[model samples]
Target: MFLAFGFVMMLAGFHAESDEEHKVAANTAMVLSGVYAVLILLVYFAQATAVRLDSLGDEALRIIDYKRLGLFFSYDLLGYGVMSLATFFIGLTINAKSRSDKWLKGLLMVHGAFFIGCFLTPMLGVFNSKQSGVDWIGTLILEVWCCYFLPICILSYLHFANKSNK
Candidate 1:
């Protein structure tokens, strides 16, 4: 998902009027997406390894350092926040003539808010206990807002791009 979105954003950057702006947006989107992908892969690997270790001995799995996992998750959340902000700005450049700019701006703001909450909630111990539902809530918001909402934004961009080409 990250790769696809990042690729689309990079391609959109090429439509910018100025070379400098295009370079900045393309580079920023690529680097941010790459970092986010790496972080996600690390989290997945850690979780999978921890699950496998559970079969060996309960203690072995229990010893898995969740602090590290949490840190990577936090980084992923932060990356999403940054990416949303960058995309919003880039949207401004690519969507200047589009009627959907207002709607896109609103979506970006909402996405930013959730990303912020994802970052802060865990730090405040809102998800401190494993039993706390905050973790699940935060995760759900991240998935829906990014995985779902972002695709909608991308589609909207594509719609406008098609219209403009005509």
Candidate 2:
């Protein structure tokens, strides 16, 4: 996911270079996307290493717990929310030149809604504990998001590839 995001950021920077008018927007998008990547990676590392250590006490374990709703989970959610914002900004920077480009732009911008949901839902405290039903709903939403996002990634690749050929 981090690699994929880096690719997207690179493309955004490329677009910024091509269009002087939207350079600031594109740069801002890349910066936000970079933050998202860093945050996610740190959370992943913490989950894999710090969370798994036996030397850690019970209290510490609870704070870093990845199995149920906990601090790390919230961090993960926050990272994704930031990512959605980055995608929204990236969408703003785009000057669509083709059908695929238009779809990509629209999808990226629309994905920003995820930030609102993710940011707000945690505050509601519904995910404080592992509820099977609520967890499934969250999973379903992410799956649906992936379905929407994958096409945008493909279209972005095609758009950039075509541009390079010209």
Candidate 3:
């Protein structure tokens, strides 16, 4: 994901009319993507090291320190939210140059909405219950939003970039 976005930024940098805009966009994209990549790596580490909820008794589970898990969630919320907002800004920049790139702009907005929704879920205590069904719903929401929405946004951005380059 970071690589794809980085590539888009590189292309955008090359095409950007002003040196300042190119530098800003290129640097911002790289840093935002890098932060997200690191956050994903940290999530993997947390998953590997954290005790499974299923392995503990109810009393033990209640006593389990959730600080690390909370940190993981916080990191995900911040990283994804920031990345989504950055992508929205990038989309706006692209749209400014190419008024015909409506689909890309719309897709970026949708992607931003999903990330915003995900960020709000924890705050709303949507996942506070430990029901498997609720967990599954949360997972499904994330999968659909991130896996489907982001890929489509990237594709639409690329399509517009290609068309504009021609």
Candidate 4:
């Protein structure tokens, strides 16, 4: 999924042809999106292969400490922050040739704002007190973000598909 997201961002970057400024913006977006992909892949690898959550007790595992918001969780959130920034930069490439493009660009930029919360929430110790509590709120927010993001992803694909058809 992260690879597909990165490729779409690269396509969006390459699609912008208005000016040198746009090209630079697109390049930046492409690089950031690539970074997002790599970061996420690492997060997945660390969780799935590097550490086995079932094998370790809550007190013993620092890597898979989802309950207390552990290392892998931080990496996951950080990867998402990178993804948000990539979206923001990719949003910059949108020239808004049509209403759909305009919507896509707007949603991407707004989604980028998620980086702030995703990056800072753990640092602020907001979830520290709830170590023993179920992180239903965080889970809900992520689901809501996915709901908001799916349309943007679909519109982005359509934008590129229409461009390719032409």
Candidate 5:
């Protein structure tokens, strides 16, 4: 989707602009972003198409239905975990020429920590959205995530704007 496209574009820009010393990190970020995009796209595609099928078997439904917490939900978490890795590597590539850039670098590096919960929580069954009364937990978690993510978007825009100015 658009999010994945924008993410890949941002990673590509970082990869292109990275200094020689940061080339490896940038490349790692770019590859991880690609994996994030692929995993996210696959989940979206499966949810949009297979979830509506009357002919889908019980086992198939168990895995792809977004209404139910299953494989697709796990894939969503895993994709974001991959994205966290991308952000961490991209953070390493930032040269931090200003206060804003420094904050951006710090946020990107700190955001990498989300990968820990994202990669492990699904296996722990703590995030299953439809498991009776815990539906609000998933919604609340995402809302909190958006709150954290909004600042990163603003700083990234500033970073790109300053780059163009320079």
Candidate 6:
């Protein structure tokens, strides 16, 4: 969840370095990043607090339960979708003069495509696990996400660190 906050800061840094032609896209990224952060924060906080209600009926509990692919899970996925949009815009704002920056830019743009799954997953109700509270598909998706993002993060770190040196 803290990734939401860091994602905003990452967008901010991108905005800070953006050229005049890219500022509009960078600004859009920043706004979307904020929305992403708020949505995720609300979902997580509710999971930590409100969803813990002792008096909730079984049906209501099912809706709020973090264990199931319920309403809150939908909201969480939506939040990530918004984050994907933010990163897409961030990618648009990059000029990508270096190879690292070029890879970062491409990765950010590709990452945005995750929004499609995030959108359709809830509506289609396609993902399921054989065991309760153990979503293997979700786990697989997350593993894929982490694997894809590793290069992006590494490239971004190198890009900024090299920038600071110059």
Best by TM-score: 5
How many clashes (backbone N, Cα, C below 3 Å) per candidate?
Answer: 0, 0, 0, 0, 0, 0
Q: Which pairs clash inside model 2?
A: none
Least accurate stretch of 10 residues (summed lDDT) in model 5? 129-138
Candidates sorted by lDDT, best first: 5, 6, 2, 4, 3, 1
Candidate 4 at 83: error in angstroms?
0.9
Question: Over the stretch 1-166, how does candidate 4's per-residue lDDT look in tens digits?
Answer: 4554655555554446536767776777777777777777877766676466457666546556555567667767777787787788778877797899899889989989999988998788666635566556557767887898889868977887887899
Question: Model 1, which residues run further than 4 Å from truth?
Answer: 1-26, 48-76, 130-135, 143-166
Better of 1 and 5 by TM-score: 5
- In the range 40-114, model 3's lDDT, one tens digit per residue, is 656555555555524655554343333322445555665676666556555544533444356655665555565
Q: What shift in Å separates residue 158 of candidate 3 from its native position after superposition? A: 4.0
Per-model root-mean-square deviation over C-alphas: 4.8, 2.5, 5.8, 2.8, 1.9, 2.5
Q: How does residue 107 of candidate 3 score in lDDT?
A: 62
Candidate 2 achieves a global lDDT of: 0.74
State the displacement of the C-alpha of residue 118, model 3, in Å, after optimal TM-score superposition: 2.8
Alpha-carbon deviation at 95 in model 6, angstroms = 1.4
Query: How well does each candidate superpose onto the true structure, as a TM-score?
Result: 0.58, 0.83, 0.58, 0.82, 0.90, 0.87
Candidate 5 global CA lDDT score? 0.86
Residue 38 shift from truth in candidate 6, angstroms:
0.6
Per-residue C-alpha lDDT of model 2 across residues 1-166, encoded as one tens digit per residue: 5654565566565455547777776777777777788888888777778756657877777667655567777777788888888778778878887888889889889988889977887788868555665545546656887787788778777877887899
- Whole-model lDDT per candidate: 0.53, 0.74, 0.54, 0.72, 0.86, 0.83
lDDT score for residue 137 of model 5: 62
Q: Give Cα distance to truth, residue 44, candidate 4, Å.
A: 1.1
lDDT of 5 by residue, 1-166 (tens): 6789999998898788899999999999999999999999988877777666557888897787545667887899899899998999999999998999999899999989999998999999876655687656656767877888788889998889888998
TM-score, prediction 5: 0.90
**Full candidate order by TM-score, most accurate first:** 5, 6, 2, 4, 1, 3
Worst 10 residues of 3 by lDDT: 60-69
